[model samples]
Target: MTERVLVAYASKNGSTAGIATMIAEALREQGLAAEARAVGEVESVGPYDAVVLGGALYAGRWRREAVRFAWHHEADLTERPVWLFSSGPLDATAREGLIPPVPGVQRLVDRLKARGHVTFGGCLQDGAKGRIARMIVKSGRGGDFRDPEQIRLWARGVARELVKEVATP
Candidate 1:
């Protein structure tokens, strides 16, 4: 039987959304029916057999909307299989170890009992935002920090897990 998966993301500058879309496509390739939607647009999680929530990190935090989405649906989410990912660490080597989420994000994680959280390197666009955002991007290396191969590998693992779940019962 095929499993239904929802890939939800909150993105600024489109980095996280791009990652979510690729992941959804990869899951489809693995024979799962998956859809990628923005966090705001998802009205209900009742239809999905599995959920993948992801967002871009800014100032070392996941986006506010993403956190709230998890919070709002915590009970439903906790009862189902869920995975989480974050596009973070603009600096290539900053994610060498397990970096715990800050207090706010920790609460979000606890609510869903998220199976796993992976931090991928994000991107910075030149002159895309106002003074402060521009300054932040310029202060860091301004380019796409995302590794497509790593993203694909991780999505494959998640898809496999979903398949395994379907096979179990």
Candidate 2:
């Protein structure tokens, strides 16, 4: 059976959501059935054979909705193939300094045996920030650091993994 994959994300400013959409599209292109949805809108993981959960990182943490979604669907996620991703790190060097998922997320990943946790560069647009974020941007720590090629490459890897899983059993 073809695996149905859910690409669910929690995005603050739509950057992560864009990534999720791209991933879903790439998966579809790879012949898997995939759909992208906001974590807040996903009612259940029961309908999907696999999941790709992503969140926008802020202050070393993931959005609350994404974290809660993982916790709420822990059992199902543990049984299915799951992947996790975080999008944030406005600094060009942020990828080099990528931090592991926060403790809570790591615990869930451990329990679920998630396939992987990838961190991609993020974008910071003009006038899209709150005061603090604006300050951070003004401090020369911001730009559109997102790399389309990198994101596409990661999605292709995910597609390959899903294909392997379908062929395994």
Candidate 3:
């Protein structure tokens, strides 16, 4: 059976949501059945054969809703192939190299036995909600840093791994 994957995420602004959409699209291109949904809106992870959970980082932590989703669905997640990602760096650090998951997210990785994880660049633009966000945009520090090709590349890698596992045995 083709793997049905869930690319779930918790994004404050629309950046992280965009990233998740890219991931799901890439997965579909690779021939897997995939869907991206807000972590909060997903009622359960039971229907998915694999999951890619992601959240935007803030103040060295993942969005609270993402963490909550992981814990709430821990049992189901542990039984399947899972991947994790965090998008929050406003700079080029994420694109230049690996930025390890923040402490809290790392804990979730360990607990869930995720197949893999990656850190991706974040985007902050005008009309962002918080005061700091507005300040950053006003100060000319805000712009989209997410690399769509890089994200698609990562998603394809994930699809390959899933294929390999399914073909085993």
Candidate 4:
């Protein structure tokens, strides 16, 4: 049977959502059926053969909804294959040199025993918004630092993993 994958994500400013969409599309291109949905709209995980959870990272944490969704559905998620990703660290310089896992992710790693966790460069725009948003945006950071080729490569790997899971048992 073909594998079914869910790319669920939580986004504050839409960049994370874009990444999720790209991943889903890339997976679909490989003949796997993948759907990109917001965390809130996902009513059940029963239908998916594998789950890919993604969210934006803010202040060293994933958005509350993403974490909450994982917590709420931990049992079901653990029974199957799971992967996690965070969109963050707009500064390319900040990305290099042995960065430690962010706090929320560190906690989640222990809880979910996630198959993998990855961080991709996100965007920070300066304008009228919350104080934190404004501050990060004004810090002279690059906008939309997502690497499409890298993302597609990762998504293809995920697709292969899901296919392997379907072949087993």
Indicate which candidate wins on TM-score.
Answer: 3
Candidate 3 regions with alpha-carbon error over 4 angstroms: none
User: Which sequence of candidate numbers ranks them by lDDT, best first?
Assistant: 3, 2, 1, 4
Over 54-151, each residue of candidate 4 has an lDDT whose tens digit, in order, gives 98988788999999999998988988788888887786632543345587787876688878877877776755246877766677653767777777
lDDT of 1 at 125: 83
TM-score result, candidate 1: 0.90
Those runs of model 2 whose alpha carbons end farther than 4 Å from true positions after fitting are 94-99, 138-140
lDDT of 2 by residue, 25-51 (tens): 888988989999999898999999899
lDDT of 1 by residue, 1-169 (tens): 7899999999978888988988999999999999999999999899999999998888778998998899888888988889988886776753455556666666677778988877877777875555756787778756687878788888999998988877887
Local accuracy by lDDT, each model: 0.83, 0.85, 0.94, 0.83
Clashing pairs in 1: none
| lDDT of candidate 3 over 1-169, digit per residue (tens) | 8999999999989999999999999999988999999998899999999999999988889999999999999999999999999998888888898888888999999999987889999999988988988898899988999999999999999999998989998
Q: Which candidate is the best by lDDT?
A: 3
Q: Lowest-lDDT window of 10 residues in candidate 2?
A: 91-100
lDDT of 2 at 59: 86
Q: How many residue pairs clash in each candidate at the backbone level?
A: 0, 0, 0, 0
TM-score against truth, every candidate: 0.90, 0.89, 0.98, 0.89
Per-candidate RMSD vs. true structure? 1.8, 1.9, 0.7, 2.2
Instruction: List clashing residue pairs in candidate 4.
Output: none
